[model samples]
Target: MNGPDPSRPCLTPESPPHSRGRSCPPSDQLGNSSSSSATTPATDLDSAVQDNIFAQAPSETSSRPLPIPAANALRHLPSPPLAREACDGGARPSPQRNCCDGRPAACNHRAVSDVCASLPEKSFARHFLTSSGTFPSAAEILKKAAFFNSGNRPHDALLLCNAGLEVYAEDADLWNCKGVTLRALGRLQEALDCCREALRLDPGNTNALNNIGVALKERGELLQAVEHYRASLVANPHQPTCRTNLAVALTDLGTKLKQEKKLQAALVCYTEALTADPTYAPCYYNLGVIHAETDDPHTALQMYREATRLNPSYVEAYNNMGAVCKNLGKLEDAISFYEKALACNANYQMSLSNMAVALTDLGTQQKASEGAK
Candidate 1:
């Protein structure tokens, strides 16, 4: 129980964001949290089974390096933080949310998936001198690398970051981007090292701090990850990614504590996560897990319902709701919930098994009643 939970999707790293093939100050720094404020559609995994949460990467798009702006434009912009990669990179729109509907997640509130941090267009123009020589188009490489990373081409981005470092060896943004790729590749130690290097070069780099937190979180060092997230938030208070990352880490910690039967501590962590980001439905799901474990079926059902409301495609929530309904002797309701679960994910084995059990139980009760009659 002190380790990871068997039935839950482990907390995935919600990476930082960059705009079209360019590093820029985080949108938070530019007072552009609105871009990230859009809701992200939720997907729930059953906590009864452990999945590779950390390895799942969100969708992103390709882009070319935009033109760097003037010095005034560069002054406040920080370097690029971690982002997704793309292949055969060229200009394209941001990653659209195809999960919920035909349109983008940003356009539809219900379809919102976890919207991570992003760089402001204005921030991408930030510039600094390179010791070797000024590569005016160097920032484009980083930007393209980000596009590649978000596009499910981490190896491409990693290679690009390496090539960039060969020329702009002092480029902390390159180092940070490298960390992002390593984390996506499940190279936790290497990713952390990259973040450290980036930090050494640009000690106050927000991207470096967030990337460090990501590596630690992926490594299952929940407390350390929490601290790093706190540091990232302190450095950039308005950063939605930082806040969301912290919430995830705390929820992970709570899950671990819950497994250990440390209910009170687990409750506290879950509460903290909710406080950090109320819109995060996973936190609610985790809370329901706690309540159900404690025999608070009514409250657990409420939480599960809330999770499904927030994320209509939350397969695990439906499965859990079915379980809770069965526990309460609501056999028909349990079957309904289980059917909903199967609707979301036909191959969800737990829901299949739960449905079978509920049906058998109902049959048994029916037989007994007939005999009594």
Candidate 2:
């Protein structure tokens, strides 16, 4: 009879319980040896298929992620995580390999610390190659590199990516991953080159397009950045993060237009930005500013309401709402809005000054009413 399939569980009744149902890779495929311990080196994956392809990539694990419809630039520069299940051909990552310690509240620092501390120098490339006589697959190397990226160890991540590229030169995801790690290290030109290479390999790669946008944005090429963001959206319309990035770019561009007194063009950009992501509160706030400038207080009030609805803690929106109300001769409403702004931020000088003026106006109006009565 033929021996058991290395890709399947042992059907023999005498197989040990621990070895049963494990779906271990062929000894030649993974390494020369198998260990019962869960603490195997990152390369010695028990089953490459066991990785959770749907798990969030390291870049998606920001402690303070941008709001769904972020109007400003990203809260933090994001690194694109590994490919999804569909993109990775269903290869999933182990939980530890995907976990990040970058966010203090989200990770077990000790586990990351142990992993980093125990890692042999050039572990994936040198040690594993020497011991197993085969390089780990691109997916495996990417997982370990992602783990290091999560721990804020970009140098290690870069090392892993470079090594993987030597063996899997045509892997687009590897190039994209390396690009993001290089971007993290502030190597913008090199990062852009890698992302461009990934784009060349996979023409419709949204991650490469998005990273290219990031690099351009960093270089202060807003218009070029906008083009890349638009290209990425065309490739994957469901990407909320990319949509937010687009909105941010548009908003920034609009501000520049407004400064140049191109009011109509600025308005068009703001409208388009809101169209891109209606939940972006700052865009609404910006719309309110434009309407207020154009002598449309009522419309401005509506826009301000939308802004406050999306972000209740938006002090600027509240303050501007107070200003709009005051201009409309609604002193009481203006004071209330000012008070809300102050509650959100007691040290906001604009609201403090506006609040005092509103209170003084209310007092003066009360005195005049008493005298008339």
Cα lDDT of all candidates, in order? Answer: 0.51, 0.54
Worst 10-residue lDDT window for candidate 2 reads 29-38
User: What are the runs in model 2 whose C-alpha is more than 4 Å off?
Assistant: 1-134
Most TM-score-accurate candidate:
2
lDDT of 2 by residue, 248-342 (tens): 55655665576577988978887887777777665666677667767887998898799779767666667777877876789899889988987
Instruction: Choose the strongest candidate by lDDT.
Output: 2
lDDT by residue (tens digit), candidate 1, 321-371: 777777678999989998997897798666676777778888999999999
**lDDT of residue 188 for candidate 2:** 72
TM-score of 1: 0.60
How do all models score by TM-score? 0.60, 0.68
